[model samples]
Every structure is written in structure tokens, then in C-alpha cells.
Target: MGCSPTRHRSQLSKLDSPSKLDAPCITQERSIETPGVSPNRKLLLAYYANETTMNGKLKGLFEAIFAKEELEVTTIDLSYHNLNVREIYHLQFVLQNFQNLRELKLNNTEITSKDIKRLYSSLELMPMMQVLELQGNAICNEGIKYLTKLFFRTMKSLKVLNLSNNRFGDEGIATLCKGLLSLRCLEELRLNSNNIYSRGLILLSQTLCQIKTLKRLGLAGNPIDFESVRVLVRSIRSNVNLKELDLSRNGLSKQVKYMLPEGQAVIKA
Candidate 1:
């Protein structure tokens, strides 16, 4: 189900600034290529610095961003916006219009499980998506279920996935592992600062051993003890494709580093 990149002609377009001075505006636009995607893609970088102004004028901002050439937009970064119920719906509506979206960043948006369910449903439209970052949100095990559906149904072209700082626990990791098995092209997976422990790491380690395309893994800031680290090392000991393993800030002793499998991956404990 992985999406193959096809060449497309590139074009640039600009949006008219909203009349109201308080509304968020499009500050920058450029053409950039993802590592494995097509080079002819436009990236729309919209910065809503003031949360109050953004909240009040969310509709106008979305209108301006997706005004005329929604199909040409390849990447969208709306991080740090504290989206509400109505605003999430507005985002979901606009997302369906993006036919070639490759990267979507919604970090620290205060989105809950209910909001993710609605938002993820729209993601099924963008089968060409490559990168998805949802760090620093409120999604828990329930939200992970919705994402698992995305993994099974679409996003087979995904390369970098960041789900750090979402506060999900062992149950969520277990659910995510099932979806991870289906991603044939995933490279980077960031799960730092979640509520995972020994049990979750054991499951994740087993899954990682099977994903040969995975190169970078971020498990920092979790509460992994020595026993879990040993288990993880043993599980992924033969995974030669894994190049980087980030386990920083988990408070493991220096002796634990020595216990890691030699020459397997660059351990950062």
C-alpha cells in the first residue's frame, strides 16, 4: 500500500491577507521536497503567534490558507494552536480539500481523543501523506485506537511519525505496535515522554525487530528501568538497519549502556 512518488509540475500561489489586523496571516511559502517524495511540492508555513487572535479568527485563517489552490499545498504546520471542538471541525473540513498533502504537524494543539477521531477520519483522504507529527497533545489510548485504523487503512507511505509527549501508557503502546507492523516504509518513530514502562517497551521492542525500514527510534523521557532495557536490547540485537536509538532522560545507569548489543545501533541512554 506504499505510495510511489510521481513527478508533477510545480506552481506557486499566494493568499490575500485578511482585512482584520487581528487574524492570523500566511507569513511564508516555499517549495520544498521531502526526502523520499516528489520535489515539486509547495510548503505553506502559517504562523498563528497569538492564540487569542487565532482562536477568534480561525475560520478566516483557514479560508485564506485553502482559498483557491488547496491542491497545491503539500505541507501544513499549525502547531501550538489550542484548537477547540468547532475549530477541529473546521480543520477537518479543510483537510479533505488537500489532495497532495505530505506532511501535517499539529503539535501542542490540545486535541483530545474525540477530536482525533474526527481529524483522523479526514486523513484517509490523503493517502500520499509521508510525515505526521502529533506531539504534545492530549491523545491517550483511545486516540491511539483511531491512529491504528489509519495505519491499517492508509498512511503506508509514512516515513517519519512523531507521537511524543502525548501521555499514553502501556495500553496505547500495545495498540500502536499492531499498526506499526503494517507500515512497510516507516523510518523514524518518536514516542518520548509518554507513560510507557517495562511492559510497553517489551512489546515495542518486539515490533521494532520486524520493521527493517525503521532507522531512528526515540524513546527518551520514558520510565524504562534496567530490566526493560535488557529485554529491549536482546529483542533488537539483530536489527542491523536500526542506526539510532535514543533512550536519553530515562535515568538508566551508565552500566546499562554497556549491556546494549554491540554495534547494533547508536545507543543514547
Candidate 2:
């Protein structure tokens, strides 16, 4: 079957902020394009990145592609746009239009709990979504609460989840734990450098042990101590499906060696 005609729409908008230091920066006014729409729109890639300098021409390209109806939009590098949520909360309109979206990346932005809730609310409408990356953002425990809730209640097709580098410590982890109890299909999870302690890591390990389909897990740069690593060892020693486990740059000591015959663990300096 051919792609939907509404998938072809073109829309663009730009906003700029003053910069203190110069390092590959693109002014908002010179970045995004104006709004336009076409029925033959088929593909959408929304890379709203930060730290990546984008010119107005690139913005115009993204907007035009994003506006197409029924188009599949994949968002990455959302840092270019502001994350205040109030200013461009209307962007959700653009977000909700992509019924065929697959991948979404929102790393290093200032997304808060409210923004997460809004995103979750819209996620229900997108049934085909599979991968979601939200690393390096400030979505704390509250935001994780919404995420876990969505994982349990709404987004069932979700496969890969990258939540590394957020400050979702014990509280956030606990909230996520409750919601992920039923996510049986989640395969890969990245939680590096999130300040998760022994308690939270243990709880997470326990949760993962119950999951049958999960394969890979990344826990590097967390605050997990030897005690937590022991808990992890105990939890996954018997796991049958686990293929990859990244615990690099954490509390693991040189004296501590790999206990699992199949899995790998890295030590920090």
C-alpha cells in the first residue's frame, strides 16, 4: 500500500535566545521555518537538538516535513528549542499529528514533570511508537512516575528506553519501579549516571528479574555501591534472557570480579 497523502505537510517556526559563549550556535530566528502543510507528507524527523548549531534553512526543512499528515516523525536533539514547556507547549500539536512515529529522543532538554505528562497523554494516541530516549533531561521522580505509569497503562509496544544521565535518584526509581512491574516486552534500558543508589538499584534488579523478555541493561555511572552490585549479582545470576549488562564507571572495585558466566561488568577508576 502507498503512504498516506496527509503525510506531506510543511510548517516552520523559529525563536532565538542571546548567547554568552560562542560554540556552534544557531539563532532561533535563523533556525526553524514557517508553517506549511501538504497531503502527500510521508516521513517526519524532529531533531530538536541542543548544543548542535542549526541554521534557518535546516529549521524550515524540519517544519515542512513535520507538518505532513500521517507522516512518521522521529525526534532527536531537541535541545535547540526551549524546554520552558509554557512557551512552546503548543508544539504538542505538532507532536500529536504524527500517527506513524517510531523513535523519539529528548535528551539534555529542560523537560519537567508537566511536559512528561503532556507527552504521555499524547503517547496514547500514537500506537505504533517503539523506541523512546529521554536521557540528560531533568525529568525527576515525578516525571518518571508518569513514564512508568505510561509503560504499564498505555505504551505497550515500547521496546527500548534510554533514561541515562537524569537525576532520577531513589525516589524517581521507586516510582518507575511500580509502573514497570507489568512491562514484559521492554528489551533494553539505559540508566547510566542517574545517581541511583543501592536501594534503588536493588529494587530495579528485583523488578528486572521478574521480566522475561528484557535483554540488555545499562547502569553505568550510578551511585550504586558494592552492596548494590551484590544485589544486582544476586538478582541476575539466574536470569536466562539477559544478554548485555553495562555497569561501567560505577562502584564496582577491581577486587570484585565477574560472578556471572555470561554477563559483563566494568570497574571505575
Candidate number of the best lDDT: 1
* lDDT of all predictions: 0.74, 0.62
Instruction: Give the per-residue lDDT digits (tens) of candidate 1, residues 1-269.
Output: 11111223223223224674343423334443334322221222232222223343454545555454332467766787677675676677557656578888889877777878889868988788889999988788888888989988988889999999987889989999999987889999999999899999999988888888888899999998888888887777777788888888998848466665677678887
RMSD of 2: 10.9
Tell how far residue 234 is off in model 2, in angstroms: 1.9
Query: TM-score for model 2?
Result: 0.71
Report how far off residue 242 is in candidate 2 (Å): 2.0
Candidate 2 lDDT: 0.62
For every candidate in turn, the CA RMSD to the true structure comes to 10.5, 10.9
* Displacement of the residue 36 alpha carbon in candidate 2, Å: 15
Q: Where is model 2 more than 4 Å wrong at Cα?
A: 1-62, 65-70, 74-82, 86-88, 263-269
